[model samples]
Target: FKQAETSFNEALRIDPAFVAASAGKAELLEWQGEYSQGMSLLQPLLAAQTDDPAVLTVYARLLRRTGDAGKGMDVLQPLAESGRVSGAPLRQVRFTLGDLSDQLRRYDEAFCWYKLARQYRPNTFSAAAHRRFIDDLLLRFDSKSTQQLNRSGNNSTQPIFIVGMPRSGTSLTEQILAAHPDVFAAGERSHIGRIVQQIAPLRNPTRAVLARHAHAYLNGLGDSSRAAQRFTDKMPLNFLYLGWIAQLFPKARIVWCRRDPRDTGLSCFTTNFIDPALAFSDELEDIALYSNSCVELMAHWQNTLDLTIFELQYESLVREPESILRELLSVLEL
Candidate 1:
């Protein structure tokens, strides 16, 4: 971490106006939970590079984190307005402005900005492609196949995968679980997805090959995970890879988090999910369709798999965190 900071600082010293270096430094600080430090560095650069959108975004976020949401909104409003007029701003720029508005309690304006942000993005969710994949996987991993194939995976119950749609309280669930002494919080990672991709080309992987896949998945968890009895991968998209996870970690607990479909769609559309692959979230209809597909898939899993899925609803969680958390811990056997 210190080495990275030093390298970033050196790059800035060499070329003070380097936007990439400045953004990299800011990101490094933010990742380390140093919002104020990042803001302090970015704030000065904004005066020199007055029209730099990247600097402005980081500065605005820091301002919001430091309780200067009004100032943050002030910084972003012009950029958002300019982007609207010229159609020049990236989705992130518009999204940051919307977030700032949200922070200032301007719900309506924030929602308007969020919609605009969606317009700026180009990717559309393919409902047909998603449905085809789901149907195909359901056919392949029927109850009988799951019983035969899943038995070959590693028997360790060390991984706890929290799968759900975006903005459906997966992070909150992970946080609550991480509070337990035996649990570790592994933030949203594509380990399981990567495993699926690696093994996808195999026609019928032998038990030895399946064992290798399981080990590779566990190995990817990193050294930090070794300290706890179980660690969580709270990637919401992991909901799509539940069958693979179930096969690899039969004893691993899978928590399916949900929110009211309308609220879930609204939240998904409003939030700026960074992944380019999650572009479906930028459009209302697309996000609604994708979320609905998730609902369908979860239902199919419930009916077909012998797995005991633990459902966590967002509304229930916020209303009764204690009861929900107690039940969550009990489900995890912690």
Candidate 2:
């Protein structure tokens, strides 16, 4: 974030009228959860660049974050309908509109905008390829193989992996857990994905390799509070690497967040995720296929892998937060 801010500032110093750099800075503030500061920066930019899709999109997102979805709708609706914007900018505008509509409970309008956004950025997610990948994981990491891998794993109970489909309440689950005095919420870490990429084709992973990767993952967590008994990695897509996680930290707690697939799919569709791995979220069919594949893989992990997995239902969490959270913490021994 510091490097990005420095780059944006340098660009602005060179060209003060660099609207893209200014917009980038404002967007960075939004990501940092500084809605008020982001809004202050964007308000002037929006006034000057009223028709600029980049400025308008960031401004609309800030408005939405500030509970002004109606105002956000008013701000973006005209630009979106003007057909003046195309490509990535248009897609962003449409997705922001979808988010605002969804926030306002205009479900049909939200879905329409989301569908339009997908048309702009076409995703080439092959379900067959994803299924094959999942099949390979299941075949390679069976009961016997995982048993051998477990012997070489780190015994640290500090790591808590919260895994599930995107928009499936992983963040909510993490927040609930992080509130505990003994737990530290690390948000979403891409360490596992990076490690898996480094050690690809895990058909016959050696014990030494598994041990080295496990150490690397723990080291990646860096320094946490000494008082923190558990640190969470709430990457929803980490469901893909649960088998590896089990082999890395056999004592680690896995919280599997489950939500109604329809709700999860709708949320994924409405939100504009910057991660390219989330390209599956572009199309509803792809989203459904990916969600089902994740479900299938998780079932295999639960059946074949010897790891503690606590299933936390989204509906249950929201409806009975206290009781459900108590049960969750108890399961994790927090």
Candidate 3:
């Protein structure tokens, strides 16, 4: 790490305006725990390259971590407003901004970031999933037909977030929903996760972030407000954030995607996700540990929250998608 920092610093000394070098140096500093100094370096780079997505993402992260939620949004709001952010950097910024907004209880802002992210590159595995997830949520928020589905006056924006380990067939279930005209497939939106991040610290997010985030998530769907009646975000790891989500959106449904442990471990090992939480990717035992953590967390979510999150095994989804879809629709009253 020290060696990398030295090298990045040397490069920056040689070309002070080098954005990559500056960003690299900032990263090393962050890794070294010198966050403020690292961020100081990033600020100049961001100023020098105002429209660079990478700068916006890293800077936003710095702001969020350092407890400056609004500033982080400020960094990306311009780019978001321009509608020009695209490619990999755009994804990075949007994801981080979404993440930060969740941490700060700005669900609306987080959804905007997530929606923008899905827009920039909806072809990637994660992106496509999230895009579909957001679309589903939007449909629920504006659907007048939901009167029949969630008849308890709790159906509007009510959702069943299917979360678990990746490669767990969350996508397959979403595909089934996509086949139905009334059910929209929001492949992997962060509605639940963002709610947890934003309001978890308050000890009671039920009255805080969940409703705000849901509203924002719905608003972020923009002009696609009339396609479906129910939205389903299927990011599996959302199990970790389920506790807070249930508290916030009591009407929100949950679906925990389960798979054979061995299969989940092997799949994670083979796939390369850049998220730091997946840091257990390089080792077998680490993967097992992380997997166990996920299971434990999901149990907590189920035990504590009043919400009903259905458990769907991946193998079942693969073998009997239609049946599972019918059962799922029955549960949602769709």
Candidate 4:
């Protein structure tokens, strides 16, 4: 992060009017939870570059994050409605408008903006391919195969995985766990997904191969992981790899975060995720299809795998955080 900050600063020093550098710095601030600071940094650029899509988008995001959704909407709506922006900027603008509308409880307006945003990006998700992938996962990680594979994996109980559909409180769950001194929050990781891709063609992975993969996963968590009693990987899509997780770390806690499908689908639709794997989120129908597959796969894991999964309901967590968190902590033996 410091390196990034220095680079952005250097870019600005070399060319003070560098819009991209300023915008990138603002984005970095927002990523670091310094929303107000980001807003302040971008404020000067707005007057001169009012129609600049990058500046406007980052500034609007900072506004939204700092609890100024109305201001954000006012700033971005004209550019969006005028249709002056195109390509990635336009898509980002539409998504930001949707976010502002959603924050203001303008559900219909938000949906319209979200739909407009999707029009700029072509949907590339295939339901049949997703179904086939799930089928292959179920076939490869059946109870018998999982049992055979589980015999040789690492027995480390330090790893905790939070998995579910996008926007299903996975982040919230991780945040709560991270509040505990013994738990290190790794945030959303792509290691598991990458590992899955690497081992996809192996019909029968050797015990050494599984061990090596598992070790690589832990090593990827970095040096801070050594200090904490437990570390969390809150990649929502890790739901697809529960069977592999069961085989590799049978003792690791798996918390499945769930929200109302309507809410989940709505949230997924509104947000512009950078991950191409979430291209399924571009359309409501695709979101539903992908969500159903996730539900089915999760149920299969629960019914077949010997592993115990702690189910955390988003609504319940919101309403009764104390009790829910207590139960969750007990389940994790924290």
Which model scores highest in TM-score? 4
> For candidate 2, lDDT tens digit of each residue in 1-334?
8999999989999998888987899999999999898888776766665577888889899999999999999989999999799988998999899889989999899989988988886676788888898988887887777666634457888889999998999998888788889998899999998877866666556778878988877777777834589999998898998877776778888999999999999888878787888988988888999999988988989998878999999999889988998898898897
**On a 0 to 100 scale, what is the lDDT of residue 225 in model 2?**
38
Question: In candidate 3, what are the lDDT values of residues 245-289, reduced to their tens digit?
Answer: 544456877777789999888666544356655655545666676
* Worst 10 contiguous positions by lDDT, candidate 1: 80-89
TM-scores, one per candidate: 0.86, 0.88, 0.51, 0.92
- For candidate 2, list the clashing residue pairs, or say none: none
Kindly provide the TM-score of model 4 when superposed on the true structure, using C-alpha atoms. Answer: 0.92
Worst 10 residues of 4 by lDDT: 144-153
lDDT of 4 by residue, 135-221 (tens): 988888877776666333688989899999999999889988999999999998999888878766776667788789999889988
Order of models, best TM-score first = 4, 2, 1, 3
Ranked candidates, highest lDDT first: 4, 2, 1, 3
Query: Residue 206 of model 3: what lDDT?
Result: 39
- Candidate 1 per-residue lDDT over residues 1-334, each given as its tens digit: 6999999889989998788788778978877889978977776677676677777777777787778989988787787667443443467777777888888898998898788777764666677887798787777777777666634457887778788888888988888888888998988887778778877666445677778878877777789888888899899888887777666666788889999988888888877776866877867777887888788888877776655589999899899988988898887788
Cα lDDT for residue 204, model 1? 48
